[model samples]
Target: MIQVLFVVLFGAVAIWFAYKVFTTASMMRSALALLFSMTAVGAMFLALQAEFLGVLQIMMMASEMVVMALFMIMYMMNPGGLAAMEMTHQKRLSIAVAVVAGLLAVGAALFGGWPLATEAVAAPAGQTRELGLEIMERSMLVFETAGVTILVAMIATTALAIRRPA
Candidate 1:
């Protein structure tokens, strides 16, 4: 019904944006396409009723993509990728790898021995809360590491932006 249609629409938009990501020569455009694709994926998660995941996906991807684009613009040889240059290397090999990966995913989808649900089961009242707690407890160190990494990156960016004496 509505859920299915929304999922399909989001999936299609994601795929289209993903295609645009690889096809564009402009680095900024590629980043934007990736952002759109990720946003569509977040929308898909929302349509699938995973509210926590949906919000997390959208927020995380948006920030990450913006930061990535900023770095590319600030540091790369071509700041804006305005010149006509090939963005990707080893085109044939990249295509082969992509094809193989797609085939593997399709194979897993078709043949993976996933169990079918025998009956409808209600979600727990505290399912999201419990899941959040479990993730935080198990990955507290990982989160701290990521936070430190981000802090370092921010410092580095700031330092690089500062004007140095000749």
Candidate 2:
């Protein structure tokens, strides 16, 4: 019963924030709405006992939204989106695509032959610890490469900022 309530709550929040993301005039607000939506999705994952996926969703969205905001600030004339502006393009086509996509999703959900787990599975002990160990063991090199790439990008950005206009 409590799980059902939480699922409903998180699902509603996700939908609300997703709507806010598209409807808001402010770019920052839109980005924040997207962040909130993603966080709510993470909450739903948690409610469904997908701890690793929940944490990953929240963390990934947080970083991505921060980077998106930074780029908006760097490139946009009105980073705050205080001035009213039409953010969307191709409204009619987008609506058409959205309608079709929504219908397809609903159809699949109704018609898909998904197998239900008959037996309750035991939860793993120290799931987080195990996940951390697995990630470190398999993806240490990937993380290192990503870190180096970020460092290089930061250096390049600093160099460009400091360069004098000829």
Candidate 3:
């Protein structure tokens, strides 16, 4: 089915980003990887017919993530991009073992005979359009407020990250 294929593709991309996040050596790399992973999640939301949520994920999380990464990079004194620096103690073997164990556990749960929720309901036709209308009508203020907050946070972070003359 198309849905299954979309889910699989999106999941594979997310997993690749997760691998980059886990294996990267520094804050900027992890943040950049996390940004990609979040974008993949937003894409998955779109595939699942959650358009509002998908847009929110991109507008709120992805932009903030990039801003945070830039702030970190700007503030770092290393002069290098920080990707080459170690952010934590090396424990590759332990991390690999833990990742394998977690994967097995997730696989077991996924394959387990979990019953579908009978109470789940489908949205009516034109549901996304209706939802968008409602948001525009009633929740526009809240949405605008969130955007302002994101802008303020980005400005504050930039201000904080800038270096002062010695």
Estimate TM-scores for all models. 0.74, 0.73, 0.60
Worst 10-residue lDDT window for candidate 2 reads: 119-128
Off by over 4 Å in 2: 124-166
Error of 3 at 66 (Å): 1.8
Deviation in Å, model 3, residue 125 alpha carbon: 8.0
lDDT of 1: 0.87
Each prediction's RMSD over C-alphas, in Å, is 3.8, 3.9, 5.7
Clashing pairs in 2: none
Better-scoring candidate (TM-score), 1 or 3: 1
Reference-based lDDT, each prediction: 0.87, 0.87, 0.81
**Local distance difference test, candidate 3:** 0.81
- Which ten-residue region of model 3 has the weakest summed lDDT? 79-88
Q: Write the per-residue lDDT of candidate 2 for residues 79-145, one digit (tens) a residue.
A: 6777777666999999999999999999999999889889754364567776677668988888889
